[model samples]
Target: MKKLIRLFVFFLMFFIPASRVCAFSDGDSVIKIIYKRSYNNPPFPESTNNQYIIIDGNKSYCLFGEGVRGKDGKIGARVDLMKDFGNHTLYFMGPMIPEYTVNDYWSDSLPAMHWTIVNQFTTIKNNYCQKAVTNFRGREYTAFFALNIPIQDGPWKFCGLPGLIVKLGDSKGIYNFEMTSFEKVPNEYNLGIGKENGDYSLYKPLFKKWHLRRLEKDKARREADPNCLDCGEGVTVRYTFIENLLD
Candidate 1:
């Protein structure tokens, strides 16, 4: 038994697949929202991308995207989504420190988005989606929110609104988000991590304090590791928003 255990440990250290940090586990109660975003330009927003946002009242929310990976095969400037309700902060990980840029949709005064509910109603998922518009960078962007859900969250970091955003699109068609489906996920905890290390404790208090250290180790490992040939050329990375308004 001792020999077998040693062999298993050796195999995991060298032969196991690269590590990925899915901090939160999926729950059966997920409000899945689909979105289609485009830059309407070439080699920039690159191409039209289909993304999904998964939210659970019991767990943290996550946005799935075809993000750019670094040479180490770890996500760089363009990160897969991570939202921590315990800390109430959003972190956008990239290759280097992210240099926030501005486009037609975002501006210097982006932290304070003035949203006005127009009271226009539309049917979505057999529920009413109320229309609301916010002017940013001198452009009027419209979003449809379902107030019945009573959840103040949306795709990416576009939360704090009165309700769940069902559809978000700019007048010029620069970017668009729309809901597609909803389902439930198990509220189970997942501990499998770090080359066969045992289960992790993700309780709110313990996790919040330990997460920063774990993140530092992750960053160091990614930086020290060599490039992954399998990663290939990455998609062009760009962002208009990186930080939260309250932070």
Candidate 2:
């Protein structure tokens, strides 16, 4: 009977900690995401940018903004760091706009739109990492990763899953992103957005209108400056409308 009691105590000691670790690791650990510019084409004539997200349990951070041309001939997006926690979403951050605008960038534009992942799934590609494919706006995007950290979050308007997104790219390959480094976020990390609602659907129309309007403006600019080498003769604009995502 004493031996059985000792065995019971041993079992409790081993199983209790293991269970606790499994619970804590199950898609609910604080994660840090660091982003770095990877590649861009067309030099200054095109827009190229990357975005990333860091999820630390219920708290989250997003890094993105605009792309810049560095002195080393590398073009990449500007980094905008956003931190949020406790019942917050990505839309709470705010609009992401280019640092440089020609003129009247938002004159006839609608409010920027936001999106969030409604569903997602992941497959382990190898022993090191897994490939996560997410469905957002009726389209699928592929994200690759080398970490097994379980947390569901990504840069911009993307979330909903059981693991952290370390890298993501659009279906057509227009945008690509990855996390370069990470660390435990300090307690001072502020994760609040002042006077902003966290609804992604509210911003969809605004983004569409802005994209179309920007294309028009680019077309007019190119017409005015025929000799401009960066204009590419004209702008070739292509974007999937927010409305189409519903259908």
- Residues 89-182 of candidate 2 have per-residue lDDT tens digits of 3333334356222211111111122334333434433213456565555546776543345444555544543444566776755455666655
**TM-score: model 1 vs. ground truth:** 0.48
Query: Mind giving the per-residue lDDT tens digits that candidate 1 earns over 149-239?
Result: 5455566545556666777877766666666654443333221111111111212233334445555765565556636432224523333
Worst lDDT run of 10 residues, candidate 1, spans 101-110
TM-score of each: 0.48, 0.49
Off by over 4 Å in 1: 1-29, 42-47, 65-79, 85-87, 97-112, 137-139, 187-247
**Candidate 2: where are CA atoms >4 Å away?**
1-31, 35-57, 65-85, 92-132, 144-148, 170-174, 185-194, 225-247
State the number of backbone clashes in model 2.
Answer: 14
RMSD of 1: 20.0
Model 2: residue 188 alpha-carbon error in angstroms: 5.1
